[model samples]
Target: MTGSNRPAVSSGWGNLLSGANLVRSLALSGGVALHAVNLYISTTILPSVVREIGGFDYYAWNTTLFVIASILGAALSSPLLARAGPRGSYVAAVLGFIAGTLVCAAANTMEIMLAGRFVQGFGGGILLALAYAMVRRVFAEPLWPRALALLSSMWGIATLLGPAVGGVFAELGFWRGAFLFLIPAASLVALASLFVLPPRVEKRTESKPLPIVQLALLTLAVFAASWGGMGANLSSTVVGMVTALGLVGLVIVTERKSRHRLLPAGKFELPTALGSLYMASALLAVTVTCTEIFLPLFLQELHGRSPMEAGYIAAVMSAGWTAAAIYGSGLKGDRRTSAVRAGPVLSLASMATLAAVMPWTGADGDWLPLALICTALVTGGAGVGLAYPHLSAMILHLAPQGEEDKAASSIMTVQLCATAFGAAIAGLAVNLAGASSTPDDMDAANAARWLFVTVAVAPITCLVVMNTVSFKGADHAS
Candidate 1:
């Protein structure tokens, strides 16, 4: 049945959650877990695959395209749910996601793969928005927080399994295997729909056109950020750069000057502390994600570690993050402060440790490089979990009343942009490091040393930024 067939609103969360509602949340969770796993698996596997395919220049474009497409996809979900109803809309998204995954598996070139990622991002983005939309429209407001928290937990599961799944397949020549998980996962979502999701509802519709031009502008901004690391010698890169600048200019002008705005109007001023916090999260994400991209390749080529070993280290990082998140909530005010402050320090230590102690070759010295690498990874992960959740909450609190949605969206946008920047920077740095003739073990160590040293600078800058700014006067409202 279509959305026109059901009612608009339903009973309280207590009623829905009392009996079968638990299972319903679980159903959504299952889909989220599958989605998160897909994201991580791809992140880990794609770097190596790109080496095989030989297309480093396009990395930013690929990620940027997906981010912009996803934003549009999320925006579209509101209307689609109103028109097609929840069940139809959700099922359609999953099918589209599945088809996109298939295209990724079959893609024979960079262009094709990028197209697949765009489609996959579009579908998955809608699926994500739909999860939130359902909770908003159907579940009682009181239960909403718990519902969202449960959805977030899936990302934790992804942190653990994504690398493992991606690494195993990379070893087995199964780049396509990553998508296999999605196939059954999609089917399971369909099956659970009969039991878990709320009854359908018909919403009023408007004839306003979809925001394609604005979206295209967003796409251009993303592309520019991704390609900015590369110089303007190439036409495509130049175009990408200009588009990003123009789009950003438009976003700023509209946000401050226009009565109608895309971001929450008061985001820049209402909670200055929160704005800093939000930006900090994005910067941290950039630092960490770049580390993730380079660390694997660095291990494989620099220290001669196997894919499995690199993956295990990645798992170690996740384990540390999980531990920190679990414990971070338990600490007192001062302890929380220490932990929060420790974020930048620990991140800096991680980079400095890698730069100083790294073994360019297995014969570098008597000391074991792997041991130090493990310590760094653990420290880095713990720091991130401590800082990120607080940052997110702070930003949301800082937003104007009823602007939480924009705040949340902005968080994702900043994060996506940061991650893209990190990847590009790492790619450029490593590429340059490798440019000279093959260096000896110590020389290779120097290259990595420089790279890690460069990475360490960001947190130090962040720490300074934090201290110089005082938050004593701002009114923090979440």
Candidate 2:
């Protein structure tokens, strides 16, 4: 999404945060924060979970299943909002999340925990997609940018608060309690939403049926990759990954021809801006998932860091992403274009640096190398922060007249699908490199290296896609 030459629309925090808008703002943003906080908390507690539940091999499946379910949830949001309206939709999402968290808190086995995560992801995805969709309906057009900013700020808040809560619980040896804590937070959001959000509006035929077949194919692809990694030998692993890749190809071809398309028109066509934007966004998201799903483990295992310390260190990436997104929102013309081009380079460099540095077991107590790792994490996040909003804005701007809402909501669908695939692929890489079969420290280090090195290709490919985007007429419309 190019933000090169659009005329500025006046929107300020004051206008967005005042009067009736205040309650509306809270309901929408609170849902986003709840989802984000749950994500960070789950990340922090997962290492402890593997230690207790004995599912080290299924580590990435946690994220893969959750993200896959989220794709289904995001895909259904438009129809749900249309039928259920804002208040009904909000309450339903909260209830679903509550049910999932309860299962997570009480689970005694890894399979049960994964099931709970899938349910939670489905609920959270609806909330996320709905929040974005509601921005246009709930706020004055001038205040959209500010409303979006307010929503994004929730992630930064989660980066601070979620880790603190999870770290405290992890340190106290009560990681299960962390999942339970989210129940009350979600309940509070539900109460606030029921009170503040408007009643059910009449249903319209504006939204189409959910693309269930496409979603099923996507899910099968991720499941195949993840299930392959659980095999006893490398041949099975290779077959699984190859099958997943093949299914991905089928999804692309099918999506282009489907009546209910998963992405906007021309998404599979790379030379055009929309296709390139979708590709870059999905690839960058995939690259980042490798870090999110495994970085805490690497820090704790390889660096001998405490749970609290590792959680915060991992959060540095998200903090950098949040800060840079806010900063990049104001860029114009050449600066904006430059940031877009530079983003993939930053991501590529960061992943490559991690590959080289993470394999050194001696990096444990060395502050110099640790600081460099932190720098790489932040730089990797900065790449995403710089380009995401701009890319999203372009998608919304370029959508055909009747398909505008679908296009807006599909952003999350695309990102979530990429995340699901990335997590599975990361699982495959580590499993093949021998993370699951051995407890040797060197084996874990080698797996980390393999994971980072393999994922670097995503960002490298993204750079090529970004370079091909034509921003000529993009600014003219917006």
Candidate 3:
């Protein structure tokens, strides 16, 4: 992957926003936004969901199963797009999403809702990856950066809207309506893709078969951890962690020998640049997921804040992430290196701050403590923002020739796996810290402390792991 094969950065956003490019960009970006928003919207609505559906024991499974299914979906995207072409794949994905959302909206039990979520994840994952996959397919080389930026912006847009939409519906005692709301927007994306996206995309013959065994192992790992957390017992938790770790080890071993690899070559070698970058990204994602999945619940349950307020506070981290990413993209040379190193440092500081402040009681009215919490969340997010793009770029720099696409797509898979594992581990920490106790009890406070403290290891370790990967020769262009 030389610099010439790389897509040129757009001189301005002007070309991407006019004529056919505008519509194509919108169709791709809209799909990503829909997927991203759906991810967070469920977080806001899950408490209401559990209340209505009686799935308190399976709370973490919401994210766990969805993410696992997403890994499958993302893995299948290349082949699906090849066989179905852009239009066919887009329509199919949208239909799957719509059907799943309908099932969720109509579900009467947690089991039924989770089933719906699986279908939605399968579809949403395709849509998310497709947004990136289509960038080279649909746009001129010079416009790639603006196209990529537009797609990236969707996550930020989702952050702003997802929680608010879910919170509004939850507050109104119409949590089901939140799922329903996604259906129409998705339908519009389908319609837009039908007209706007090229009917036929060039299909690659090198599409690999799905690594079913590896996927199964990854799924089992997540299931083990989630099941352990649900057990809410020390023995079960430890057993589950060990089992999950065992499965993960099998995944690594299998990836090394598999014909179709889930990760790029040499990723298993930790001391190498590619290996270190992948590890750093995975660890960063784990830390981020811990905060995203559980923070709102903590704020609401512990501080007596309204659902809307708690949701917004949780969004503070995402706000920081989006802002810093955009700000960091313009950086170069020494500043970029500084930002990369500063990321984990800030992340560690935020987690430590959260451990101290999150466990406290009766400070809700002070406003100062709440402000501090938001600042901590933002700083933690900022840390990831500063480094993520650089880490991503380094992956491209190190990807084995002819395997760049696999390498790029695998980044999402690695991140999703980390998220699933993180959520399960966070659940375990919460349970161990006494999440079963009432929110006002000391046990619940202990749970908050444990959750933040445990997740902080991800960043602390990330700092050390990333330091070995020298990014001095990175291609900073799109």
Candidate 4:
């Protein structure tokens, strides 16, 4: 259903922060916070997990499977919300998350850990989608922007607390405790949601039919890529990657022809402005997943940093994103367009810098390489931050008149799909470099180098594709 077309009231952040709105705000944002924090926590503790369970080969699979399951959960969110209502949906999601966390805490094998992650991701995805979906339902029109900003800020908070909590547990050689730690927090959020959120939406619209075939195709594509990465030889990797590419193409074609759509019209056509924005967003998202999925491992292995140090260092990227997005949000006219174009340039430079320096085994007591790594991480993340807000705004403004909601929802879907694929590709790179099978320093170094180099292509491709995205009418939208 589309949002109300009524003109927004002239309300400010104060309006959203006072009275009953305050409780509603906390309830909604808390759901997103749980999901975001869990994601960062998993990333921080993954290296420690592999060390104990000995499945370095499937390291990236943790992220890949989680994200794929998340996509499915997100796709099902609307139906769940319509059937179960906000309080019920929130409680159900929390139960799933708690179950998954318990399984993770008890897991003795990498396979079991992966299964837990998949379940956790499904719950997290539903929580995330519900938070965003409920905003339009619960908040006044004037409060939408403020509510969204508050929700988005949860990721920034996650960056701080997630690493600290997960890192401490990993440092203490009790990585499983990190998973268990989430249980109480999630329970509290669920309790708050049950009390604060409405049992049902005032206006219940029928949920649209799911794009099951397209989603299945997308999932297969990621699995195919991951499978190839796990293969013993280059030929197998080639065959797997090619097969994945074919499946992706089929997904696009199927979406184009299908009555049940995943994205708005023209989203798959690069010549269209909406299509270009989606492509640029997807490409930037890929760079993010590629870096985040492996950064902690690289830092711990290559720099001999402790888990706490590596986790904190990895979080610099999220800090940069939060800072830059706040700054970029205030830009206007030519300045905004410039920020959009500059995003890829900075990302390209950061990726190249990472490729060059990440492989180096620095001298004892030297901190220069680490400094450069952090700088590159910040720049890479800033690249996305500067461009993403504007891109999203433009997509909303330019979407087919009747399909704005579809366009809005598809943005998150596209991001999750790209993240899943990026993780799979990164696993392939690390495996091909032989880093997963061996503990050799050089192999790890080579894996770091090749991974950065491979993901560098995303920004380079974004650079070329972004230029075609015209800003002629974009300013009006902003």
TM per candidate comes to: 0.75, 0.87, 0.89, 0.85
Instruction: Indicate whether candidate 2 or candidate 3 has the larger TM-score.
Output: 3
Residue 449 shift from truth in candidate 3, angstroms: 2.2
Model 1 / residue 234 / CA error / Å: 11
What are the C-alpha RMSDs, in order, of all predicted structures? 6.2, 3.8, 3.0, 3.4
Regarding TM-score, does 2 or 4 come out ahead? 2
What's the count of clashing pairs in each model shown? Answer: 3, 1, 0, 0
- lDDT order of candidates, best first? 4, 3, 2, 1
Model 3: per-residue Cα lDDT at residue 199: 70
Off by over 4 Å in 2: 1-9, 46-61, 106-112, 140-146, 171-176, 192-203, 229-232, 361-365, 434-436, 439-442, 475-478
Better of 1 and 4 by lDDT: 4
The sequence of per-residue lDDT tens digits that candidate 3 reaches over residues 417-442 is 77777877787788767747444563
Q: Rank the candidates by TM-score, best first.
A: 3, 2, 4, 1
At residue 474, what lDDT does model 4 achieve? 45
Which residue pairs overlap in candidate 3's backbone? Answer: none
Could you tell which candidate, 1 or 3, scores higher by lDDT? 3
lDDT at residue 10 of model 1 (Cα atoms): 42
lDDT of 1 by residue, 300-418 (tens): 66777787777666666656665666556334355555666777888888878888766435566634677888898888777776666555544544556544444544555556555
